[model samples]
Target: METREKILKAAAEMIADDVTATISVRAVAARAGVSTGSLRFHFPTQRALQDEVLRRIYQHFMPNDPLRDRSLPARDRLVNCLRQMLAPAGVGEDARRAFKAAFAAFIAPDPSEQVHTAYLSYERASAGRITHWLNALDDEGAVPQRDRAKDVRFLLTVLNGLAMERALPYGDSVLQSETDTLYTAVDAILGTAAS
Candidate 1:
């Protein structure tokens, strides 16, 4: 790989392993086997490097915007896409860790309003896919498509809540039970039987 790509890849891997580290330019340069000046040539500031890495991390999780598969059945595709988000393995543990650290940073003493804005932007990007899937299914006479936004919001809310719960203390069984509940609820809402 090229030096810039190598530096990014190395920093991404290290950040995934430990997001609390200094993650300095020299450290990334050493990891990329390039000079510090070379690394700085690509990223003039720490924030720039981190922001690029963060974008890369999210892209890795939902590449090619899998959520935009309007050709697929909405309910089924939404469920499948959501399942990927719930599990920590699909997105790479390191990227997940990096995101978590970034989230923590956002919620620290001096939070960024831009981060909140970014959350909505990212949500809309992913949620658009789910919403489109549902609308397409409705158009095909599969679903009634009433309150499509509400349906998508509810489903996403439940899915995200369950995933967060699963990641918290003393919530394994809660997570599993909620997952079962979600499957049942979604199946009924979509007018389908469990496969």
Candidate 2:
């Protein structure tokens, strides 16, 4: 990768470690083995670097898959979509640490609104994917006569709620239960159309 891209990637990796941590440009430059001035030339501010990293994360989380094609059954498509969203893509200790650090930062006191906004953006991106899947299901006669958009919204809301719950304290058992319930509900929804 180019020097600028390398710098951004290093900064992203660092920020991912602790999304809310006030990371220094010098640290990023040191990580990237570039001059601090070079890092600043690429990303003038910490926020700019963070916004780019977040954007990249969002894009990776929400891929443009060909599952939307009508050739696949809606049930399969919906399941695939959900799997993509729920699957943990970040790997190894470093990435996990980054996620946890960033997560805690977002939940920390003072100027918390930005973290909330980032969360909403992530939720909406996932929701949009869900909406696409549901609409496809409707087209394939997989979702009965229900309002596809409403169903999509409800499903996304439930999914997001479950994800958040899983991230919280005292949610381990509840998270598993909620996942089971979510699958059962999904199965019922698809099964209803066949009945």
lDDT of each: 0.66, 0.63
lDDT (Cα, tens digit) per residue for candidate 1, span 113-188: 7776656665765565455556545656767646767778877787666655554445336646765767765675
Q: List runs of model 2 lying over 4 Å from the truth.
A: 1-73, 89-102, 161-182, 191-195
- Cα deviation at 132, candidate 1, in Å, is 2.6
- In candidate 2, what are the lDDT values of residues 37-72, reduced to their tens digit? 888888898656655655565457555654545576
Query: Per-candidate TM vs. native?
Result: 0.48, 0.45
lDDT of 2: 0.63
Deviation in Å, model 2, residue 108 alpha carbon:
2.5
